[model samples]
Target: MIGLSLNRVLAVLIKEFKQLTRDRVTYAMMLAIPVVQLTLFGYAINSDPRHLPTAVLAQEDSRYARSLVSALKNSDYFDFVAQARSPAELDEMIRRGEVQFAVTIPGDFSRRVARGDQAQLLVEADATDPSATSGAVAALAALPDQALAHDLTGALAMRGQAVKPFEVIVHRRYNPEAITAYNIVPGLLGIILSLTLVMMTALSVTRETERGTMETLLATPLEPLEVMAGKLAPYVMVGLVQTAIILAMAATLFHVPMSGGWLGLSAGIGLFITGSLALGFLISTVARSQLQAMQMSFFYILPSILLSGFMFPFRGMPAWAQWIGEAIPVTHFLRVVRGSLLKGQGIGDQWRELAALGAFVCVVTALAMARYRRTLD
Candidate 1:
């Protein structure tokens, strides 16, 4: 029987460390993932996001209107990005997600305020992501009391004394109830597709290489593109089935609305599935083994989950983080899914995100083919 020998234990420990150092990809992942999580959680993520994009439609250039706008900006929750020419334009901006909020002041705002009449300031918010808007919405509660304090001074000081002053009518558009499932269920399609498709495709391809079957397969007359197409075809079906199941559950169990038509949703899903499979193929080409492929896939998946606005608000991230998120296919896919399911946006409305997903597919497929060709040579 082997006793607990210190010398043998020390030898095994040193051997394990040597093997760990030899596996550079795994070693690097261990160190990098923690740092990535720390940096993302510490600096990039913000729950109470400030300076959200806001559109203004001031029908009158009155002092009271200006005061309200100033108060909104001063609250640090709203940043006026566009001056909407009409109500239609303002609604369009909110519909297209150009702005998180829209403020509309009536033409007779000052007249009514001066006369101590019930003046209304309309605030329309895109509440698709409830957490993103809750803080900003709460900030509005205090605005009516102080927003007009300066303007209501002098002869109109009595006007400010009214219990509510002017009414701030906030219209929470799209998911007025602020159901969390309404946001999460649609986004789950992207996150699940990313984790499963990428990992499965990468592992499958790399498994063939580890088992020495890749060389035999490469001996066939099939072209690189044809081989990749064959490898990815089954996974595409898997992705489709997964999407159908998730969406069905979302609608039936969660009662999440499917506002957009199937055409736009199908287009987005197809592009995303193709892109994710291609990305996995690219990773497989880069990885020397199945373990390496799995490790690399985790590297990609972590960022997708964190930066894609899946677990956090996308707009809450810093500019640099948002730029990085833009490059990830999952980010655009989330927009497409959420837009279609929640906002009922069509192809015309979500064209940018669809285009981004298309670009990802093209680029990744091209890179995968190139890398496979290099491996063949």
Candidate 2:
């Protein structure tokens, strides 16, 4: 009896191995997903900002302005790329998002200094992205104290005037404290939702298809929309539970404050969950088996993580990369989440983001419906 049981167990094991080998998607998940995730996280994840593009709009064209420009260029924080001749050009560069900072020197900078009048230097920086903006501002703030002070001392000696005391006040609007947690927590919401909702729906739906239950369900009078809705309702509850857990953890453990109203935040989360579930339903329609659904989910998840500004600041990425990021729904959702939670921005403040996300939901849902209809046919 023991020998017979062993033979039966071995037969089952052989059959399972054959099935596993036959599924290319399973083999890919076993082999490719780990390596890809590791390489992406290891190389791409970094908080330290570097090589920020900066523009100098020097009107002085004097020795002092040249010295200041030289000082900025020598520093590791900036790349002194262009010189703007006028405020219009400077404004264009900043508005076009070509440069993160524009260090402007007044035409009478040297003349005013010679007469011992306090000369003002304008350092206008882009504050759209909190992290890169902070780094650029910090570097610029230090420059006046270090380089300007030395230059002022030399100018005093040249003019035989005494070095007068003055205050260097820094104005950091948008995100004054440069709080990293404030920036990261909101984006994390979108990422966590995407991973959980998308993976769960994709796997669960595919499991039904793999087990032959999908055919049984289709035999019922239920419409495709009804089937999709039934499959998604349970995962929506799961997404809500996960969102609560993450929000609590973020507040209590990480001390990240939620500046927006809870109602608005909840609404945003609901929209995000719906969009992600639609994406998962779309994936399920494309995939024939559970393994294929999982692989396809990973492909979606990878881009969402990398290009969504969750791991890296969006402005810090190259232009081509930024364009790629724009294609992902998580990118728009992150902007809404972060802007609302950290910046205390209301719907009016982020109407653009809201519009974009709404459009994404409409587009993805329509595509999912089309795909689902096709699959049923």
The candidate that achieves the highest lDDT relative to the unseen native structure: 1
The local distance difference test score of model 2 is 0.73
Judging by TM-score against the true structure, name the best candidate: 1
RMSD of each: 1.5, 5.8
lDDT of 1 by residue, 106-163 (tens): 9989888887788899999998889899999999999989898877777688747746
Clashes of each: 0, 0
lDDT string for model 2 (306-339, tens) is 8677878775665666777788889878877765
Off by over 4 Å in 1: 374-377
User: What are the TM-scores, per candidate, against the unseen true structure?
Assistant: 0.97, 0.71
Each candidate's lDDT (Cα)? 0.91, 0.73
For model 1 the local lDDT of residue 47 reads: 87
